[model samples]
Target: MKNIIIAIAFFFLSYTNAQDKKIYALEFYSWVGANDNISYEMASIIFDSNLDSNDYYCNNKEYNALIRVKYSEKGVEKIFDYNAYVNILYLDNQTEIQNKNGAFYTMIIDGYAPAKLIKGNGSYNPDNFVVSGIVTKNTPRILNAYHLDDAEFLQQNIKNASVKPEYINTTDEGRAKIKKFFSSTDEMYRLLMLYIANFD
Candidate 1:
């Protein structure tokens, strides 16, 4: 009987710890056409569902919030959020500039769909291709802003469909155009920050 009582107590303790392991985005919403300038109320609209705990690879790659934990060991607070870790590393070491710059450029430069691969007959892979030269590249712009404000849900969207590496042209002129796009992205990031501040 004593052994049974101890087993029951251990089970309850284990269950409580599991519950406190922290699952985020149970209330995420999927906002469209808006940046992360969303209000807490607005954020709630996209924070409607729990993270898909079963998809560990997806969780690790893009939407890490569900798996990241904030814990304390030996009285020191430790955070597992990938973004937070990067930010701290950036601040603590100026020598890490190259790494930081690479992160920034990659984030901004690869936001758009690549030029579609048109077949000799001019047809393309409908599921994989964006219309060539139609020139509407708003998704990444909105996504970047969303990252700054409602990072949690934005991270979730990235996990769902946006984090995969994309391709652009490798020619010199194409490279120049890609550079231009990244510059525009930086400007958009600044402008969106200003816009949000003014509205707030």
Candidate 2:
């Protein structure tokens, strides 16, 4: 009886620790026609589902996007949902960051179809989705945002039933334009790109 009781206590403690883990998500958000003076909201909410870029991909590319963080604090949860750019998430903890080899993580905000770089203190798993482009209605609201590749700048809208991105037809020039479209000179930005592309 004592052994069984002790085992139950240990399991309870383990589960509680997992539920109250201290973690945060770093979300990269951006809009083509926005500036640095944009304002956002701080919200606390949860959802039933979470997905990645593979579930909804158009093409492969990167972009310089604004950041929003969703995390758990003192047993409470909070999130930031903003305009479209390319969602690349990094989910990690301070201890893991110090121990792991620059390991990052990935996750979507659940509600938005856009990809997110979810930074949480969970594990050393890396992001595999390559977000292209996402355009919004000049507002930072998530619902108004459109996942471009429905990609950032990959697929184009046409009334005609043409599958695949327009760039598929013209190889050189189209690819060049895509490169320029998602170009970033920032050192950290480039590093994040590397992490998102291939870091297992």
Candidate 3:
């Protein structure tokens, strides 16, 4: 009886360890309009057990989330060393999980302004660009923001999908033109879900 009890405990411990060793998949998808000129890329970052030990930095206090990710693009695979701000949404219901299946977490990364370029000679040049994206266990949809405020503006007005190109321009006059064109965040979200659904 003693030997049987020890074996059962060992089996239970092994099963628990196996369950704890889960690895989540991170996927990415990007869309650029014909008229939109933006260059950006996304990578999954895995951090040490402690969240604060990574290299990536997040300005927002609430967004300091990191995980281990195996990022693959164009037939190339690489691991990220830094940490970044990510919002994770956990699906509780099995129906919800199956509805948008396979994704265990949803992460959103916002872009900021005042882009800079480093030359091989160690010289820095001015390159003003912003890249932002929404990531999930299966897909990440990235987009370029015209200016520093573009991402914030889009998030604030996500319900109003009539965003015009002029509004994204980095100018006071352009900001005023935002009302002229509206775009739907729900629509964009649906499109993203569709992309993931079709992905193999």
Which of the numbered candidates is closest to the native, going by highest TM-score? Answer: 3
Clashes of 3: 14
In the range 1-200, model 2's lDDT, one tens digit per residue, is 99999988986775564344322212233332112222222221121123334522222322223333343534544333333234334333435434243323332322333434333333211111232223223111122222222223244531111111222223344333323223353222333343334312
In order, what lDDT does every prediction score?
A: 0.25, 0.31, 0.32
- In model 2, which runs have C-alpha deviations exceeding 4 angstroms? 1-23, 26-28, 33-99, 109-200
Model 3 Cα lDDT, one tens digit per residue, 1-200: 99999988986775564334322323322223222343223322211233353422222223432222222334454332223444444333546546454333333433222222211122111111233434355343443332222434567632211111111223333222221111232112222233334334
My TM-score estimates for the predictions, one after another, are 0.17, 0.17, 0.28
- State the TM-score for model 1: 0.17
Taking the tens digit of each residue's C-alpha lDDT, what string does model 1 give over 1-200? 99999988986775564444332321111222233222111111011124454632121222222112122334543322111111001122324654333222111111122223211122111111011111122121112222222234366643212221132223443333333222333322232223223321
Ten contiguous residues with the weakest lDDT in model 3: 118-127
Best-fitting candidate, scored by lDDT: 3
